[model samples]
Target: MINATILSMFSLSGLNDMTTKHRVTLFSFTLLCYCVILLVNSALIVTITLEEKLHEPMYIFLCNLCINSLYGTAAFYPKFLSDLLSNSHVISYTGCLLQVFVIYSYAATDFSILALMAYDRYVAICRPLEYHSVMTKHRVIWLVCFSRLVSLLCQAIVMIMTSKLELCGSHIEKLYCENWSILKLSCSSITINNIVGFIVIFFYFGHDLFIVCSYVQLVKSALKSREGRKKFTQTCLPHLLCLLNVTTALLFDLMYTRYGSASVPQSVKNFMAIQFLILPPLLNPIIYGLKLTQVRNSVLRLCRCRKQVKGLG
Candidate 1:
């Protein structure tokens, strides 16, 4: 077995082509984007928590969604900003594995949460009278916990499998550490890793299929009544849009990871690498904030209260 201690750090070669000027510009934009994500997501979470009227199953799930966005972004931005300012773009082996766990778990949790949201909509729209009984407070908490826990378990297994591999290289061509990138460095047969990875992907693919099926039934039932149609447009539309946004962002990253050509511009490749990390966190809250009437009103009310407090001061 190759000694794991030999590969202490992995050089991130993706940033090598950037000049000092470009790095500073990229840093400024990234910082601004990260701040916006934090502000919007935190605002939504706080709004949902404080407003007793908004403490229903739908809003609670929305709160968890925002929290997941924040969790995912925290894994990327701090280290990314530090790297942009540093001379060497390298991450320690342990740190790389940790990043893989956090980032992938965040993504998996997102899918889990979205799937739950789809079910919530299904019950709320398809069985309005039974919705309260079906989505009770205890059940909501259990569902939320299940979403987070399953993701953590899956990603932890991936991380464990990756850590056991003896790496032969210390260079990662991407901007961030991912399981596949680390797997590429393995000196031994990665058949087991590949199998486990495929299993995880297929499991989450099942989540996507579930969401799609849920929506299919929802749309069919919703079209029968004007009231149902309005409810679907008011609430389900935002969820659908957010789902599309994240799905598209992830597709870009996956395509680039699998089929990216060296002949492609480094800037384009870098954008693809970070698109999922950027667009979903930034867009989810915005889509929900503008689309969900309850959330929109709560946010406005909170803002107005803040302004009144400042005036009183």
Candidate 2:
């Protein structure tokens, strides 16, 4: 009975009533942004992978950050670009659920990896002698897998719960699928879903708290020595910037989606809806590439080698 009541398709209002000219322009700009995200992130991932010097734990985590940006954006950009060109903005129920899972899991994995990076930095700076033994190749792999698997499981449960929803409505006010939007369509009580959702939210919020505590200890340790301060300034700054970028973007998205003023302009509303999709994926790689000296040198070396090969060909 519940399965029968679930809507087969969802109607999205975010792109409705756009003029033909506006659609074309929006499509072009969005396409450009997606390409840049792919190019920059892929370049960074390639640089880190090909450069043996970047095989350390910090660089490996940075590589995961780049890869996750690609992973997350791949879920949104293609579908969004298609919606921009299509007359009807609709999605199948299964497709919506998959999108929700990929996107939120991307977020979960991002926070997880960033938290791990904070710990890596703490060990390198605060406990220099034990850094190698603690952040070994096997250990890093295990940590990455554990974090991602836990996130996937949590999101899987949420999606399973969402799939059971007996939707009374089909219209979604936003451009894409999200947990809150899907939950809003349910015809019956959603206490269980809400509870599970908050549990997941707090779980990732705990990542933020962990990062803060790690940094607090780092600050104290770094202040004790000039070398410690320099090390923190050199490597840890990029992680902090990336963390701030992602967390702030997420906060903006959540705040606007849940409690934002409807009186705000539609364009602004749209930006708030997609800011996370745009900013973090685009900025994370760039922050690391520019701020980390080793990464900068490695990327330059990679680019020069590419040019030499091209000339020979």
Candidate 3:
């Protein structure tokens, strides 16, 4: 039935009929939004890092969040925008591989960063006495480095392993480089490849969940203090929401792979795409500025300074 439906759709649209204008329009709009998001995120990171008053674990974690979101957006947006603006759907073999590698690399790093941020919050709120020692600048730097390194290693292994296979065709149905779609195009036996993909997904999701849950438990313990409970919840809510977004998206991807197309509705898929790509970057700064008084003041100050400079100029 799936094959018949695909054949019917192909017959209607014609296999070679390339009316990609609509797709290009959608990509263009998304790309513009992402560019704005990247700019704002970068500004926030600069503010946090250069401003002496913003030097704390909370702001440090915000800096990491901004950096991770930038990396994630960078991995996918350049190629997407190129394809959109130029109407060039023809990605080179190497380009496709690089996209797959970079996308997953940043994705893994993003997840790791969220986990570390959760840990930071847990330490800051729950173990206030030892927060500074526990979340030292050196330690955070090492964790960031280690997170990206591990992601790179995983992506390297996947790329090397997949490179050995002969591709049957280049008819990737999806708009972007997805592992399952690429794997489906290979003429070679993909049993081992599929197995590896499953294992990677399992470990990635399980480990991230474990880390996040640990922080949740720690937050629970901290919330027992009546004085800190309200502040702690306010501080942690945004991160919790962001973590939930990531986890749900990963779970949906896994379910889609396991059950094929029937696993999830198309609406759910579309919503997830928007949530992952569009929502988080917009939310992070707002969450910080609104939840924390200092960030709001800093942003207001920056705005006033910019206006003053513009008036003088």
Candidate 4:
């Protein structure tokens, strides 16, 4: 087995699809999208932090969602934007692994946080009497931290397993670094890696199932009362949309990787590859910003406050 440590850099073949002439156009659009993501998520985060009324468990979890979106996107967008201009598309092996860790952990953390939010909602709706005792501010904070820690640990294990592989090559087929791409470069049998991958898959997908089941209970509890119905419509709808968006994006990527046709166009493949990274991060904040009444009102008030100050000045 060749020492995988001997491999230093890996070139990305995914960016080779489009002509160099179109890069500027693509870059501008991508930059705009990223800026919007930053703008919306930051606005939401600031609103949640400054407004004491928004300090409940649900809002705190939503704030964490926005913050995590920023955390996840930062790992990709900057490096991708750089590679957009540069002729060379290579990353150091260590850098590649680090990227895998960040990107994957971010994704895992996303599911974990969503599940936590679902639990928060379930408690609020289904167990209203016990909600105060169950989901204290400290408990929410602790759950947030615990979710990220578990995600990091899970991905850390994957990274370790991937890094130990005796890589046969350095050219990755994808636009960004990830486990499967690195696994493809391996010279050794990846049975253990594959096993760990399955375990992680089951682990995160468990989040989806938990959320769905929570919604089931929530709906049952909601149907009995008018106020419960209103709460479900306003709050749970956005959460469901977010879950669908993330789930769809992930399923697209997963299915394509596992069973997709080789002849499919690179553009489509690129979209599938980045669907989760781009859509959920961008959409989650927008969905929440618009759907949640309190947040919408706060943002409007915030805007008017800024306008008032400008007028006085």
Off by over 4 Å in 4: 1-5
245-302 in candidate 4: lDDT tens per residue?
A: 9888887887787678989998888889999889999999999989999999998999
lDDT of 2 by residue, 1-313 (tens): 4433647888888877578899999999999999999998998999989989899999999899889999999889999999988898899988989999999899889999999999999999899999999999999999989888999999999999999878878888888898898888888899999899889988998999999999999999999999999999999999999899889888888778778897887777788888888999998898888988999999998889989999999
RMSD of each candidate relative to the true structure: 1.4, 1.7, 5.4, 1.4
Model 1, residue 270: distance off in Å is: 1.0
Q: All models: lDDT?
A: 0.90, 0.90, 0.68, 0.90
Q: What's model 4's TM-score?
A: 0.97
- Stretches of model 2 off by over 4 angstroms after superposition: 1-4
TM-score, structure 3 vs. true: 0.84
Candidate 3 local lDDT, 1-313, one digit each (tens) = 1221111010111112334766666666777788788877887887887778998766777787788778766756776566555534566667677867876776677677777777877777777799889988898878878877888898888888877776656665444566776677667688998888777777677767777677767667766887567756677777777777667765665565455564555445544443555666666666666777777778778878999999999
lDDT of 1 by residue, 1-313 (tens): 6644468889898888999999999999999999999999999999999999998998998899999999988989999999999999999989999998998898888888889999999999999999999999999999999999999999999899999988888889888898888888888889999899889978986888999999999999999999999999999999988888887887788767867898999888889888889998999999999998888999999999999999999
For each predicted model, how many residue pairs clash, with residues at least 3 apart or on different chains? 0, 0, 0, 0
Q: What TM-score does each of the candidates earn? A: 0.97, 0.96, 0.84, 0.97
Q: Is candidate 1 or candidate 2 better by lDDT?
A: 1
Query: In model 1, which range of ten residues has the least summed lDDT?
Result: 1-10
- What residue pairs are clashing in model 1? none
